[model samples]
Target chain A: MGTIARNGWASLEDIRDILYLTDARLDAIARDVPIRRWCECFDLRARTIFPRPKKSQAGVVGYDGVAAADVAALLIYLERLGYELEPLPLVERLMDVIRSNPYLTNAQLSVLWYERCRHKCEPLVLYLADAARPKLAETRRLRTTTGYTIEVATSADGTPIWLSASAPKYRKRRVSTPETCLQCGYVWTRGDPDSSAAHRREHKKRLSYLDPQPVVELVAAVAAGENTISVDRTSPRWKHREIYRRALAFKREFGYDFVQWQSDKGDDDPGAAGVLFCNAQNVIVGACAFRLREYQGRSWRALQWIWLAPKYRRSGILTTRWFDLRRQFGDFRVEPPVSEAMQAFLKKMGDESLMGAPLSSTLPER
Target chain B: MGDMDPAPVDVLNDEPHFLSEPEVAQALERMLNEFQRETDRGAVLIAGEMVSAQLAAEIRALAPPELRGKRINELLKYPGFLSSFSARCDVALLAGFIDASAHRSTVVLRRLRNDAAHSTDAFSLAVHRERLMQMCSLGSGVAASVSEFAAKSVLDDVVYRLKQRGMTLENEIGRNPFSSAAEIFEHLSVRPDLMAVLDERMPKMELAIGVWLLLGLIVHQGKRRRAERTTGDIDDAN
Candidate 1:
């Protein structure tokens, strides 16, 4: 508590969102690794992969099974990477593993994190840097080289090490007990460990702000059971006026979901990739669509649209599935002059610039 | 849409640049030199007494609230036994600031520096190949041997990690100011505010130094309590 004297502590929800995004790497890993059946679980072999690995037998096998601890990526990838490594989702089938499994270890979580964050680590680094920017008001004694990074206690991701700050200087002469320097002639004793009480809380509580992933996924799975999240198709339930009116009302309240996504088969670009967020029984809840579009004759990938049903906003679903979006569109640039809600989401992203140049055709009125 | 979005990603065309291995090694050397000058009296002796004492304070800060003041003074007696600059490099590695290769280099270099410091005769890289062979990074994978050039090359990249290149000393202090509290106290003693404390009491320089030491001690006592101090906490005391 003393370590954090000035700044306000983040709420559980704030921690949840951050942990969710950090764990986005895990979600990515689930999607990326190729899952050939090896008994009950999926086998991730280094040799099966193309390029350098297939030439020589350097590849080792890894598995993602139903068990909690059984969650490592291919061994070769592990050797090449560390906490900073972010590997892309090589297989789409890990989705089933993630969807079905409830428990995962810290190591497995890290591997999944790498899979989600693979190649996107630089951005993740920036994202963390944005949130845990070195404190501005922090003062240092000039000439003192003792360096310390006031750790964002809740952040799961950031620079792993900071300079160690020392305690009071003490010395012992002829006496058995050492006397500490106290200019005022005050008596002092080495206080106690930061927490004298039993450190019964697992390392996660000490190291991380909150335990992540399992519960959030459990909630999502429960919610998934109650409501459907379809890949692409939309249900006729969208035509129901009462539901439509409520959806519109939500749009009015949240400045999102102004209109239902009308799948335009005619305007389909082969480069266009999309997914739909569906409610109970396939009600079109939300859709995030991306397409490769030419701008000023320069070709660039563009986010066609990200429409979410009002209720789902801030629910962590969008962020949880954000890796899927990146996997498909390769990090789509959002059209600027976005809706207020979209802007809020971008701000959450910690890098507003990801909302790149606005779509030429879908221009918001100035 | 009349206006086209510039494509959301083009604005971020440039990625952050990282130094190559040689450059990183050079930077490590410069950083180590700077750290020595800053922490020690410009000598690279066993740094435990200088840096480790400060680091001890830090580990204490993270200690349970009760152990704040009286813990870990034994380190002062046998300072060299506590650690070397290489151990600090280990902390840097643990902190994830430096990558694996850099960390490996630190382990290797720490031994070389220790050997050179303790050597009776003039120390040379050429003579230390046997020692170099002991370094995990420099050691022969098989029952093979390494050339002096190879050991020297390892030594080059084995530069220590101090402050990151772009990060300011302020940033490092912001993270853990008390680790270098003594230096900070010395630095602050010359400040106009601290001097004003002297100016108000007595203009004599000797008494002022004594007063400053007392104040620094008092500040150290404040370290025992684990709470953020308001700006007034220190200023009003003065």
Candidate 2:
């Protein structure tokens, strides 16, 4: 096989090259784990090279048992990511990175980490908690009774830490300020811990009237002249198209469809927002696809995105940029089945229909 | 070169939306107002809106067509029993519009309101905040969204059940009242100021449904009046 290009998924040849292994050794490794599983770690599940598991009376099993070369390609991906391709559980290795890095702060960084690891980090913490072990708490991803998704990480002392998986590290933002809690019916001042505490007591016990208020001082953002464009499977720019493909693959894991892709082309609908991220130089850095659907009898825009590229990763630029899209879309909605990172961001932002943060009136020439 | 086509991406089976904390709060207010209005309907019934047989018919017209012919005179005539807010809640719940949780909260709110209404002492939401929070929290299933976490919509649940029933049932002319009701309700949710004209908070889904029902009755009544006048003219000509 030809040498793999940048942003190309691992091919069997690429895998063999990365492992520097004899074809026989690669075969043995393939027998141990399917290459598709490995590619999934890198958010490459949508690629054609990915193995499709065969149907048998033994029941539908994993991806069509992968080739040695496929496994080689996947290992190469890990090595490039600086994650050793040892036989250790992938999640453990991911956790190792997470534990050592200590800087997955804010939505962008945290999300970027997940992207770098291949959107496969969830399984690391998966099944960690079981009913029998009080200390080993399996985190439930179910929406709260009030409808928000707050994935609380607990301290050894059993206190809930409002860990921010998304943007704006909420290390201590857990006191339930009035701007944050959607499940309660009383008014509490934003950022006032005392009022928040009092509100929580009333909320947990169930007292008060529903107080609805618009968000105060939402930040304005402008990514418009930033050279954004959508990508499809046919796009020669592998990096740009790969983001949307990964999103489609992710949705499939949850058993549903997201933005339509007509073969390698995008869905016919113009409303479909697909992997749309480019810099002023028109360099691809990210992807975002959204559409307006009838929600509860009203038109609501659904947003799904991957702002995971290195260029936009560290700073809060991607999130703030994504927020800018809402200005073009007046009061677009954000909904469920969101990633842990997105959920944390939504929790902090207070789940109103996002109408892009307003652009700063102050001038800084581009 | 042509590449193999990728499968079309579509929104998944999972429902996704973008309701903020304030929107959820607004939705909750609409729901509480929904419960309160049912009680208010009973109070208004006591105020003798039922004195006009036409008004009674109009209220019933909002019901399924089969129930539209049923005389509401007896329901209207019962002053104290029908006037009780809890009784009204039971009717809405039993009508299959609200869930068990809403039924229970309505009864609880009725008692709380009664206490406030009957108390000689000055009633303050400030003093009652804790107690009110505890009571409203039961099935209200809401959390204060000042700063902790955000999710849930009191309005969604309220309207989901209502839409399920309303969409299936039609008026005398066979029009689904649910579409009109839902559109109007959605309009109201976005307009807090419009909602405040009647009350500081918007009235709930029930009131919007109520508007549709009353409009149907008025339209039907006008048609009947016009038909009668046309027949009388023919008789005069003969």
Candidate 3:
């Protein structure tokens, strides 16, 4: 089979040459995964070059019946939950978990790691105490309400070690700020044996708010510019045409006639700025698309873009460019901005709608 | 060359190929079958503890336990309870569950889903797709473009609606509203400012959605007002 292009574009030969699976492998894949469901969810056209299992007289069951379905569902569920299945970091973590428990299966180790994470608040020493066999003689050990366990010990010189199973690289923690006892309002300062009792009594509430204001200042560049708007195709939000809706809305409200497409073979003529500007460096903004002529109807021009950078927007540069456009194109016959709100705002600012010009047949799109 | 058509290619090419509808449908059927199989056998049941506790108490009460702990847990793992399936069902299953209280949300959701379902019909998905295509200006393959756009829209709309209602629900509980339009906007996981920051920042359609949100907020606020008034009256009487 011909090699298939990863981008979905392929010649007829390319389609015919790639490794075309027989009906059996396709059947296996289809039977095992919700790959079709996933494809449909993402609006992809999928084809199975395979056969499927024949329907049997099985009773209608809800969410139970097959392992294949569960795995497929799990894959999709993980995707929906924003879990990066293919991320190297996650794979590395999974490997680490497996290595930590050499005897545990991947699934069991994963479950244990997740379950153990739930007890993150407990100190490592306390965990050691719970699991380790206690010494016959009384010794310093961490204890919890559940029970006492063996604790890691330090040598006479205080090497800070855990010798039970010998996990050296994984264990490295130092008490920075001493714990404080809330009941008596005493700090566990001066690392002494007596401070452990006080440390056990302290319980400080961890504080975190949902959304906080940004610490960095938002930067602005130039305000009003008749520049074309370009966006990355792979942008998460733009992939769904959200920006188109917003741009259309902006046009409708500001009374700008935005051309959906440009002529495939047009010259360097500026398409339109929708709005005009009196000054070039700092111009008032306009709403939609615009077309212009500089040399007495000879040089047909169009200002093709509107600057959308934050720096310009915040400083009201776009707004100013729009107002300036009115003055620059006052002599030439140009479509006036006709958004009710825009008109009112402009009228309030003493920019009246031209009296003699006929309103265009095309209405500002909503 | 004049009369006969060209011969069809024999081998599959290396180019990316999307599955045909029939292929997709068959695959879905097979997946459903497999799903049924995995769920049939008992899995690691976690919610069994709850059932066991209840069963223990019932035994002490001199009553026979209704079902085994495992049986109760088996019921909870139904696809309906899973968050991903729940989201799908929210839009797909709404036609069946629509009621007086949820009618409005359901109607809006149905319309959005309808738009999504008929995405290929240019006229239907035009409004949504054009926005993504033009804004993103993807130079990649059409399938990739569509996939990216569709995926983003699903999450964006879900999170947007959830956060919006979540904020309202939270405010009803006598807490400071930790959410604003921005938070909901962020929850949509898209830049809120970009909608207006386009070179030709047009907000007419957005303004309509804004109007809808504003109306919803007004009603929500009105409910709060009535609630506050009743509490104030109670305080005054006391």
Candidate 4:
């Protein structure tokens, strides 16, 4: 391929070489006075579409310079379209459009012709006429006989502002099948780029949200001052249900072999009452459930499970809340087979007496 | 011409030979096949090291000047703050230096490196074949069958991108009008009243004075650059 000039401006000969046009043919096209006149009237040199003459040859310069890309696009359009239509009139109207819209450039017109009009069977004059429409020229809406409306809008720099074709939506719907993401359960249509991209974005988001590490950090960082609120069944049933769902999810994520709350149906289990720690966003970050049991004719609330986002643990968040729990439940006992971390926490709390004896009968079946 | 012994019948063999297009293509293909055969632990270690180096460069570029050079080395060296590959990756992601996909690929690369280094059994690409393939696919933006060639290409692409980002950030930093405390003070000295006010109130609090002056100078430089850019855009439109 021939190289464009470093200055971004090309001579007529250079343009002809890049376009692979014969010298005689380009000469014939350039001889048209209006084309040269339009070039001169636009002061193409001032716009860097043409190189300015050296100081010695200032006023003597002719229409020898041009932006190669813009001129190439224009020449290609002319060569391709001139055979079907009257070349002079087409050039005049195209120049008129260029002259009227300051933002419209020959380069943009060339792109529109090549991308939208070149392959179509429609007359080039009709397309040019639509393009010449005042104000509406930005979005050239052409309704084809085949029942599709093609809209072409050009940006200032020759790229499409937006291109759309109003085709039958039902045709695509009939041909495409919907695909469901196995991990996130997001459903989107196959072979549709927008849908596939959306599915990918949503899938990433869902994965990140489910990743406990970041959430634990965020909750830990924000779990101070009035940011966290403790909720239970007494504090709005909906709040309790939402926290209960998060608690279950956290349990499953922690790889618990068996969840105690899974046995209970819902908030209706009067024997079950839970406390949930929520962050400023009202998201459940820590939770614990207690079950009332009569041991030796004395009723006591037995701790079924206590869970906090890992980062929030050992931060004195739970220790401060212990007194409140003691006042509310009166007597609380933890189930046996406590984890080492929990045992350490219990030891720190001076509540080793809260540990209960192992009850093999109450254990869920594996 | 024929009288000079036909110029000693020179064979003209000393001229450099250039490969033809087809010859070059064939040579590349052969090289790719050879690269594909490198599925051993050595390749994983090399890939891990290259990625770590690129990420470290990017972090250096994005870090504040105070954190560059020795301070940054202190953080990234063994037994330092961000010594582990995992810690570096996490810090880069949190600092918005790399996106989630790149971070995930780096994580996968780190794990592969670990398995290759620490495993007692024979270590090869097969150890974490699925994860390696996924990382390559994400890095290269293509879903192809696994090969060491593809893995190397993906790593090359990642390193190239990080290097480019680092260069761009360095260029932007270089463009700042006041890059040092001395330069900032020199610029501020033009306004004697401002300097006088500081001189009176900033005797004991030298650190606070430097920070305040630096912030003001940065904001002023930013506004000036933005205005110049806007004017250039307007001129282009006109």
Q: What is the TM-score of chain B alone in each candidate?
A: 0.28, 0.35, 0.20, 0.46
- lDDT of each candidate versus the true structure: 0.36, 0.41, 0.33, 0.52
TM-score for predicted model 4 compared with the true structure: 0.24
Chain A TM-score across all models, in listed order: 0.27, 0.29, 0.23, 0.35
Tens digits of per-residue lDDT, candidate 3, A205-295, equal 1000011111000101011111323222332232113233324334433466773223212213343333211123222222234454344
lDDT of 3 by residue, B75-184 (tens): 33454232122232233224222122323332333344444444454232234433323322222353244444444543454345444444444444433222454654
lDDT of each residue in B1-238, candidate 4, tens digit only:
4554444443765322222234333433443333333435655665566566656655666666788889898988888878777887888778766666667767877887898888887764544557665564443533352343333443343334333333443453334333344543454445343333233222112111111222222223333444566798799999
Clashes of each: 57, 68, 83, 0
State the displacement of the C-alpha of residue A95, model 4, in Å, after optimal TM-score superposition. Answer: 59
Question: What would the per-residue lDDT of candidate 4 be over residues A6-89, giving only the tens digit for each residue?
Answer: 444556555445334443544565555434443443333323243466787656435456663455454444434332222232
Rank ordering of all candidates by lDDT, starting from the highest? 4, 2, 1, 3
Ranked by TM-score, the better of candidates 1 and 3 is 1
Model 2 C-alpha lDDT per residue in residues B174-226, reported as the tens digit of each score:
44433555553764465443333323112222222222222232334433444
Candidate 1 residue lDDT tens string, A177-203: 323333222223333333222232333
Using lDDT as the measure, the top candidate is 4
Candidate 1: true interface contacts recovered: 0.00
Residue range with the least summed lDDT across 10 consecutive positions in model 1 chain A: A209-218
